[model samples]
Target: MNIEVSTANMKFLECFSSETRVRIIELLREQSRNIKGLSEALGIQPPIVTRHIQMLEEAGIIRSELVPATRGMQKLCILQLGEATLNFKRPEETHVPGCHRTVVPVGQYADYQVSPPCGLVSGAKRIGMCDDPRYFGDPERMNARMLWFARGYVEYRIPNYLVRGERPCMLEITTEICSDAPCSTSETPSDITFTVNGRELGTWTCPGEFASPHGKFTPHWWTKTQYGRLKTVRVDGSGTFIDGVRTSGMTIEGLDIRPGAELRLRIASLDTARHSGGVSLFGSGFGNYDQDIEVNLWYDHHNNAETGS
Candidate 1:
């Protein structure tokens, strides 16, 4: 019942649109109430009550059930997610445009193939058609529809050029991981933890419960199935994710790149029963987003380190 709000739960925290929503949630928290009870207690019109209730339901703040009382029938609404905690931070002032240290490292394996259970899917043919069980993985595709997994592999070659005359220290590779996204358009929560050079980097909770372009980034007609939201784990020096356990105030460390060393990205998932919701993935490149997992190497190019926002 505890709702931890960080930038990750933007949608949930942003659901507070009106004071009615706040008051309605307060009343529902005490006990499940029918529309008539809410309307009478709040002294509001029936239409207003209904409108607020709908918004709360969409925000997943309350749940409703049918209760037969002295009356013929009554719909009872109760609070769902609770213990809400939110963190607000002031925006830092800085300016840097069209500058990302990352570069697309993997070349298109036009004739790539994945085993029956999985393989590389083309990013071209994947935008907006991910709800289907069959659109899992298909090579040579782009713009969405790409998924494949194994004991963890490596992509994005860290150029040996960085090892010219410096001592090798650390390696940094970035990618996304999943337990195995279910074959349906259902809400599936997962925890994809990362490890670097055999070191357990940390764990991240992927609350696969958001929206995306069903057919395109911003389609005109909205023909595709707008399912749960998605996420992209970006890689860099300070921006690296550490113990992001609470989805709030989470920070990362130990990402300093050794002057010269091969970096490896080791991704794995644990079904600790803590998240029995199961795993499901849909990215623009994997079957939908800008591209597959983006990875980059951060090192002291000339005795000076660079920073990313």
Candidate 2:
């Protein structure tokens, strides 16, 4: 029988030694306070509070910041550690499990073989529905599409665990996305979405325009078409979020790939009512996000999480 534990659990056990560290956590749980604020409230000296704060920061139990205050500058701190527990193993180690198979981060894009009912669009405004390379830059066309049924799933292999026999129970895949250029901003929300395994994850209604959340203004040309308003919707509730907000859906769970597994993500404007105005996906070559569509998977020793069981 095999049992496993996570790195997060050990860190918590290590913190139980210091009472000062524990009190700081209790205080921060109420509100974020600066060093001076903490000293005054706890009736401790600045240097002592600073020392304990340093230890907690090193332990990953809390984080600190230097923000301007009306009176002067101070180091503001907050606790980030959450509820976690650990299971103990005997000190006299018996059989040691060797390195586990792991999945490394990789990039994913569209590949074509047999698009049952979908198509493709190229840069410079050309749409390819059952298209040939000749449609690469057709002025009348401006979208790329490809599709299939039963075999509809696209493939993206993720080698989540890097060792020999370890498997992962949870899989996290994150990517910033948008697809098929819509004729108008109002039409951008109708894109259809799916995973590689023929499992219908869900759909995301993108913002009418791709706007930069970083405060940097989007370029003029891209504004006409919804190209800069980057919006992400999760496929599974367990997926990671982008811009610390959007997340991917259940692309894979209880994942058990050794080297890697093909990650297939397919997009279609399936909302017939809105997709009737079909759109074009402006990947890599032209967009403010300044990157081609990317997908990241997070897993451990064995199978995937949501799909792993």
Across 1-309, the per-residue lDDT of candidate 1 in tens digits comes to 124446666556666867877887777656557898899989999788998888788767776644334545467776655333343443233211111244332332122222223333333333324333333333333433334332222222333434533322222333323434434232455566555545555566544422332423323343222322233343332343321112222122354344355444444444353553333334443322344445433233332242221
Q: Please, what is the TM-score per model?
A: 0.40, 0.40
Residues 265-305 of candidate 2 have per-residue lDDT tens digits of 55444544343323334344444444443443323343356
**What is the C-alpha local distance difference test score of each model?**
0.44, 0.43
